[model samples]
Target chain A: MSTRLDFFIDRMVSQRACLDFGIAQTADMQGPVFELGLGNGRTYHHMQHNIKGRDLYVFERAVASHPDSTPPEELTILGDVRETLPAALTRFGATASLIHADLGGHNRAKNDAFAQLISPLVEPLLAVGGLMVSSDRMYFEALTEMPLPPEAVEGRCFIYRRDS
Target chain B: MSTRLDFFIDRMVSQRACLDFGIAQTADMQGPVFELGLGNGRTYHHMQHNIKGRDLYVFERAVASHPDSTPPEELTILGDVRETLPAALTRFGATASLIHADLGGHNRAKNDAFAQLISPLVEPLLAVGGLMVSSDRMYFEALTEMPLPPEAVEGRCFIYRRDS
Candidate 1:
């Protein structure tokens, strides 16, 4: 059995690999990027460096990341994701080029349940050809599950593409 | 410290993630793909499914893979990679969009030595913007080491891109 450290490393590495691939695939696309959770803002900061000429919107209940990694307030949508995500769809339309989420807690069952709850809220925001990279398996009606890029662990990270 | 199984799984997953990323990056480039080792032809088979409109050349000493995974004689360049790789540089010039090598044995020191030996030869064959994905760290003159995508274990799988 893998240790807790191994699992954490797997989650982190998979997150990086999949997110990088998603960024590259959507490089030519014309849409903003979305971060569903802003805990620590590590992923958002990484995206800011690699992604050029796009608006990066962050959805979170509050700002608590390190000062260097924090998103600007103008781009921050502060509230519970369930409320904020739907509001985002109305404000932005189905125009997100990439939507990333790592919103689950430590408990496996609870995380899975949370994934089910937010999957639909997250689904319509993706533009066709955009990608949804998540730390948990998401249930989407239109977004197709894409094969994970090479070093990403099977269950640790997921990529779903809106093809239509 | 991770167990042996953890290491093996990390290597396998990293290889897949990097290869897939390399393929996507080079999808618009014009050149053939090269697979340096054909052991079991598993990686080669995976590439075959995802890569379209590109010739794939396999470098191997002899055919030992499962019949289902074996490449045809026309695409298989039989001989030690040490010799065949250089010969390929002469025949194909610096035009490979993606060159993947996993040519290492079980010994760590020996693999490191092998990577050093082949790095120079592998360095010249990649087209600018092409990517070289290897299981061992390479010593290259002009190729730039790229940050591994998320979920790819550091030091397990490496990707080098020819930037200029």
Candidate 2:
């Protein structure tokens, strides 16, 4: 019996909780961080402040965020993710310690389609024990779903880890 | 603007998320798990299923949980937490890896007072790096507040880690 507002709150809170856990869990790992679909750059801004000793790269078609939240040009990859993500494998290899995506909108059909399309592209990017936080359930061939932290709503946010 | 139901859902989801994280984080740590208030034994049941490699002890004055949720006599300490928690220090020593407490009710003043009383008692039982998850804000001199997961609502659930 949750309203749309309740769902939104759940999504936001769950996203934060998973991100915090991912950052902490991967603190000792060596790799850059990737943020997919940095709409308004809020999540990217959060990563910018909290993540240490790791470069954060944002994948987006373009930049349109709060003045303070936008990433520097050098760190921002401006292109469709379908193109940029695969290209990243060559430049960065499968060495991302964390990859966060919130690419889907209100359309359920479109969201599912997008998740299926990107899941494979995202899976190969994570390093061993690396965490993936997503707004939609993603299809991964090898990545395992990690248990959600206690503030995360089930189905609202998803976390997957690369074991190999 | 959230309804009472929304708050309830947040509490439930946050509780589950925190417990899962605490259980996983402490999987390699030494010492047992403690359930400070086994109200209805829902959380206890959860810990029983998910927790491994450690014994789980419940502190409660009496047992009134559903039959399926009840703990065995040996693991269930049947006394008020104010008395039994201190006694636990002598029996179990300061080596609990995870302690989950939901000792407060709806009354703000009463909940605050209870949290204050139990915070000190609870603080000494944890092993270093052990996590404490609570339903109310606890005043801890040494334990640091860990960031919440994305699904958890702020102030609805709190997680603290004993770093020493």
lDDT of 1 by residue, B25-89 (tens): 99998799999999877788778777899999999987787565688889999999899989999
Q: What is candidate 1's lDDT per residue for A1-164, written digit by digit as tens?
A: 34333455578779888988999999998799999888866787788878888899999998897666788889999999989998998998999999999998767899999999999999999998999999999999988899999978899999999999
lDDT of 1 at B139: 93
Error of 1 at A6 (Å): 0.6
Give the clash count for each candidate. 13, 15
| Predicted candidate 2, C-alpha RMSD | 15.6
Candidate with top lDDT is 1
Query: Per-residue lDDT of A58-131 in model 2, one digit per residue for the tens?
Result: 99997887676788889999999999999999999889999999998767899999999999999999999899
DockQ-based class of model 1: incorrect
Q: Could you tell me how far off, in angstroms, the CA of residue A150 lies in candidate 1 after the best superposition?
A: 0.6
**Using Cα atoms with residue i matched to residue i, what is each candidate's TM-score against the true structure?**
0.51, 0.51
Model 2 chain A lDDT-worst window of ten: A1-10
